[model samples]
Target: MKSTVLTRRGALKCSLAWAGAAVWTHRAPRALGFTNANARPRVAAIGTGSRWCQRATGIDGPHGSAPSFVPFGDYVAVCDVDADRLGLAVDVVQEWTGKAPDAYGDYRRVIDRNDVDVVQISTPDHWHAKIAIEAMLAGKDVYCEKPMTLTIDEGRLMCEVCRKTGRVVQIGTQQRSDESFLTALAIIRDGRIGTIKKATCAIGGGPTSPVIPQVAAPKNLDWNQWLGPAPDAGYRYLAGDNGETQSWSRCHYEFRWWYEYSGGKLTDWGAHHVDIATWAMEKGATGPTLIEPLAVKHPVPFSAGFPTDDTQYNTATEFLIKATFADGMELEIRHDGDNGILFEGTEGRLFVNRGKVAGAAVDDLANRPLPDGALRAVYKGKEPTDHFRNFFDAVVDRSEPISDVHSHHRALTTCHLAGIAARLGRTIRWSPTAEKIVDDPQAQSFVSRAPRNGFETEV
Candidate 1:
């Protein structure tokens, strides 16, 4: 496949064009019945695992549940290494669209199809950049899941691929589209939080060790294919021989606990909370200047002969990683805190979690009337509503959605840096403008990994 190289100026021009045109106009292709229905965008769902299935239903399912019936295009295909989950997605599409769409085990097959205009990827963390870039190269737009890349280099490559292909890529960091976060960001931007001095993001840590009694792969799963670009490794189901549920320490959803497949709770939860932190600080396009993981005190005995230091579940079980931004603002991501973000400024501090937002004297700020047109503007004139709807709207209009790649990369960068620091067990300084580590050759190498043969990322 031929890839286009975009000059920096050209890239900036395209970005500016997108910024100007995407705000008001719906950019998705016309609906199936519109005058230009032939040009209507046809979308395919790649990585039809549990999460992707949920997102698909959220978009194309019953009205009031999904976005307003936008007369969107069909789900032309579904792709997954797991046949069972792929079949389930096909069934959902068939039931909703009254048509049996094609199915494939390889996402490349879906990308090869000229009929597929957009590819929505909800693959594992490692596969996010590879599949999304491939789809863009195949002349398809992409809506990829959060933590946009597993590493910093991957994020840069994704941005370059999108620019080169002129593809519309949206990252599934849904909190940016949420009203509560938007409102919070608006207040922070409006100086309600004063000159933000420090912030804290707390997500619980990973299990202490690899799961035991690694069982055989299930009959319905293609374990090799599921591993994909990742190094070939032994297969071990969390379920033990007696059918009793084993430790939730590793594999699949639990894969988040492992260093090979994910960044543990850091990226798992950091993707959301860190995203809010960066957005609130208005640093969505940039990354941290320094990252230091506070040495952790592991509860498990180090000499226990158990595979505690094993590659499986190597993520930090307990630690505080502090990231310093360019503007002297600091973000401390910890394994133990209030389990949300705490923003402190000269005036006071505010704590926000999924359920509520409160502060030292938050009622005063919450009660104070926001400037006229403030709340409505924060909502972007749309009701503080569904994240999936925002993506659909961006798809139809060709506009950059609230949680686009640029902002997603900023959050992902923080997550990746934190993981790197934890893995290296040291502090690292970064040159965000250069996108490189300063004075640390060892830390710089962790920015990317070697892909398995025949699975190299081309961007």
Candidate 2:
């Protein structure tokens, strides 16, 4: 908590010491024999409604491409606010484990169990930090989805808790585990791209839907709990005959489009491509010192940083946010160009995404392939094959996972700063060492939000 430069090692040491009390609190006796390397940790799935089997079974079909957790750990519990979605997740867990897992609507109950060793937080942006912090305090490792925090302060607090508990956490920036992206990062780190001059991440835009009317929320859904720490608002349902489905624009996947819940494409895809770009630059634990909004365009009008219209979606639809690091490297995050990262250095240029890792350096890899352990080194000397597997292995080894929270918070800070800059339609200065907005009192105020009373985030 001191005002000093934050290195990964320093953060970890501070957290481990601080969380000593927390570990004692969670040390109550339980059935033993679960710590063996071969024994799978008991995992609980919080916010399972939206994530459901999309990771295990493909969204497209049974063999969907997303990562699955069934093979890595025992899926012993599922939690979600929506009864309908929770029922579905419970079914999938039963099918996968051949046994029923406990189901709960409140995540607190899930984390309180001594038998639960790990929790997968696949919740909305606002809920990520709260669940992750409590899960750690309760002595549980976490595999949280990306864009780890909704605000700058939340990111810092999450890191503090992570270090305190010394819990193994793997942020869901799975690109760090992808072969192509790993190869690209190795080439860049190996200086294949000379002195990095600039980087670009072209994350696409958000989808807009027709305005819907406020309707009664489905009886099967716990709407208040779904809203979580977000402001109190009426349920908006798509104009329809029956009330079975919520509006596609505001619920589930579409929640990313609303500033009330998320930062749209800025955090949605920026959490992916922008994170990799920052990692390649070796600035993972450090945020930009300055962020300038080149050309910002939001879905709706905004004043200060808050959306003026609550009825309609209001996150940035198209933007070109330029961030400048202390070392003078510039990162251009835009909604145009290809959906990947373009790294331009003095020697060569490389572009990479889920599809392909192309350009000169990558072409060079075919002949002069990277040495063994290159990928492993990038993944903290662990296997880079599967993100979920990496988390389970870390839980057993007590080692840091590939995508740790320190780097994630720093990278996520860039996305949050870009969103703040775009929302205010002005350039903002940032003090990376202090981790706050510089000079501008108004911009400084947006660093953290006062959560609604019951949902207040306390560390």
Candidate 3:
């Protein structure tokens, strides 16, 4: 099989050619090397910051020690706006692969490389959609970090781009790969909880108040590039001025707190919890019809940190947002709860978090013998064997991976709406079908932000 070079024009042509085939049959493109065992998928990693580094750590090292990363794919390149982190990632890849993968400051260069087949993007919230869209348009399969887009429009656009390009995309909402979440969703779908009346999804507080004092960016870092697509804001080092210099901690992980850089906890952790909660409720492919921010009270004033009264952390720290679906079910998103989902139903209530799933009704349901043929119906089903493995499998099979763009967009829409309500401090009406707000112009404005001149997203 010949590996075709992915390009914007090429994507358009392929889309037109494959449209009928894609719809008539749910088959994915054949694997790049189904007939050849020696052929491995050529891959690369973009935004080798903290999270990306962590995910890469799981891949086999230079010796091919791990089962999955046993030289299954080559890490051909790495890109990052931060020079320091980029160099560090390149070193890791070189050390593991025994060859130096090309390095680039601009992601476009990496995407333009015809040799690369896959790109794992772990950039900031604002950069996710832009890079993912471009990568897909360029014909590279993408594994992008979650809360997949900065705005609802971007999420939808991403889905369209992938569909049009015939590219595989896996949103990095890892819980979708976790067993606990799978089991819970299976239980709920099986009707073990009777009927899900409502659910409470809670995430921890956002950054505390009182802005941290400004400090100079490290000499080794490219602060300007790190702020890609976002407006130029003053850079602040995580550690105190002249403090200990850490390699990966420079400009990446800490960026999650700033509104210009990220959606704070709303997109950070909320991406995980809200995604799972919505998936369990069978709302992963759709969104809420109504959303209103409940009354929230902040604590006494203090300086920057979690729960502080600082304006720097613009995301909500303490708040509740009620999302009502078209089906008349409600989901309460709050900053406080048992750190999991509470499914209140007609038969009994079920509480499930990462560590455990428990309910008075769960015991009765467990004790009763499952009816013939009923067990299979409740299993929300598993990915194609392995979670990450499924990504590679889908790449070869041309089938949609478990965590496709459409479902991710729905989950992200819910997360984005929660953030918008918190930012506007009011209830807002949403039209899921049209993907817009109704009547309230003030609320509508928060749907997307004006990107910095050169980095604006192209629809």
- Models 1 onward score TM values of 0.83, 0.90, 0.84
Runs in model 2 deviating more than 4 A are 1-38, 55-67, 239-247
Q: Highest lDDT: which candidate? A: 2
Put down candidate 2 lDDT per residue, 190-302, tens digits, no spaces.
88889898999999976665665678888987889888888888887675432223345467666888887888999999999989988989898678888999998776668
RMSD of each: 6.0, 5.7, 5.8
Off by over 4 Å in 3: 1-38, 54-71, 238-250, 297-311, 369-384
TM-score of 3: 0.84
lDDT of 3: 0.68
Worst 10 residues of 3 by lDDT: 241-250
What C-alpha lDDT values do all the predictions have?
0.69, 0.79, 0.68
Q: Predictions ranked by TM-score, top down?
A: 2, 3, 1
Using TM-score as the yardstick, the better of models 2 and 3 is: 2
Ranking of candidates on lDDT, top first: 2, 1, 3
What lDDT tens digits, residue by residue, belong to model 3 across residues 218-298?
Answer: 676677767777778776543443212232122456566566667767788778887777777888767898998785534
Q: What is the per-residue lDDT of model 1 for residues 1-459, given as tens digits with 9 covering 90 to 100?
A: 122223222333435344334322333334223235576567788776546654333234332221222255567888877676777778877878789779898776786676677788877888888888767766677778777888888888888766655567877777777656766766776777688899899877766544344567767667776776777877754443321123443455566666677777889889999988887777877888999878653434333212244434555688788999888889998988678888898887888877777864446665785677665566555555567666666666555667777767877888888878877678989988998999988889888888776677653
Instruction: Quote the positional error of residue 107 for candidate 2 in Å.
Output: 1.2
